[model samples]
Target: MLTDHHTHLAPDDDPLDEEALSIERIVAHVTAAMDRGLAAVAVTEHIYRFRVAKPAWAHPYWETQTQWDIDAYWEALSEAKAIGFPLLVGIECDWLPTGQEVLVEALRGRPWDLILGSIHWVDEGAVDYDLYSAFDHIDSEALWRGYVDRYARAALSGQFDVMTHADLPKSFGPLPSPATLGWAYDAIADALAAGGVCLEVSTAGLRKAARELYPSRALLERCNQRGVPIVLSSDAHAPADIARDFELAVEAAVAAGYSEVQQLKGRDRRPVPIG
Candidate 1:
């Protein structure tokens, strides 16, 4: 059965963006998953956008980033769940170095079906955006090294169930040398194997500059070699985006010799065989 483990609603409360914040949108999102033949879908908004998670975010944008009362998100999610839609609640939480207890405490006893560990930023700059857009400014090899090192640490932290986008640095442009990329993948695979964290295979990269799945072929192959579990996702932010490019994601998994994909219900993970 198809399962989309990552999704979001309104990025911000833009009055112009009513469709995203409406109950109609959440229902449509669930219907989209149904249309895609999904058995389950998770509405995993960014934890940094909610005031309850503010203490966990360690970015300069903390002061200026869009902050909304998280209760509205829960209300919408619960409404969708009550309708008997196969939707589940989740959050994409950053695995920052500090205040991890705060992040955990903020989410304690919440009805989360999954907690995706993510690395959206490295230091203060966004690794996938600013660093990726201007690859010439930084040492590509050094950047790759640093990101992988931190990713390994995040996986080993035991704070998340699934590690989101293991090879996110490849999203923009300017990749590291083949040797550097190989070693980084090795490190990530080793760390994931040790931590027992499921890897997220996101289709969003197809729409990004990467023009491929979140983890490239080489990295996925590494996971396969290490027998690391994997989860499939579209990383949808709107109804129309649910299960986007999912066929391609499955094809990539097949290419990596993976025949089973992971399904998450809360922290419990089950493997669904791919046909």
Candidate 2:
């Protein structure tokens, strides 16, 4: 059965909405996933959306997002699972160098099925958010190199189950030549393999300006060659987006020589064959 390993409870644009973490919304997301032929999905809300994660987020944009209670989010997901829904409680954690300790401490002892590591911020600027675009001032090469360096570090940190959107810098536009960045991809693959972390094949880029799947074919092949396992994700922020563009995601995986994908539960994982 196909499973979506990454998703979100809050609206990407309006994470502070009171109804974002409601049990009703959780149920709707699971229902939508089932309708899309998915056996299960993980509701991985962004870590910065919770007030407790504020210490790890220094960007002013993050200040506007630390409005929700993580306990309430966990309770809501637990309630949904208790009622027999096939959804996993998860969180999408951003990689912040200055606040790694605080972030790790805050996430301790939770029954998380999945934790998606992401690098949305390169230093202080955001790679995807138009309001604080890193691309505005930083040249493509510097921004991409900075992002990859952090991605490798995050993969080696042993803090995440899957690394989502491996090439997130392309979200706003094209990046430097992939050939020149082969060393970066190798570093990421090596780090993931050493840390026993799975790489996420996300279709979220298809919805962004990049208009492509994450971890370009070249990078995916490198990770596969390095024995880094992979998980499929849409990075969906709403019910209708669950498993969106999955056919394309699967095709990309198959092309990259992936015959299986990882399924997660309570931080443990098992491999499921890809069709």
* TM-score to true structure, per model: 0.91, 0.96
The candidate that achieves the highest TM-score relative to the unseen native structure: 2
Alpha-carbon lDDT of model 2: 0.85
Please provide, for model 2 over 144-253, each residue's C-alpha lDDT reduced to its tens digit, 9 standing for 90 to 100: 88988899899888899998888887778557776647867787788889889999999888998778898888889988988899988998888788899999988999
- What are the lDDT scores of the predictions, listed in order? 0.81, 0.85
TM-score of 1: 0.91
**Per-residue C-alpha lDDT of model 1 across residues 77-99, encoded as one tens digit per residue:** 87778888798888888777676
Model 2 scores worst on lDDT over the 10 consecutive residues at 9-18
Colliding residue pairs in candidate 1: 113-266
Look at candidate 2 and tell me the lDDT of residue 261.
92
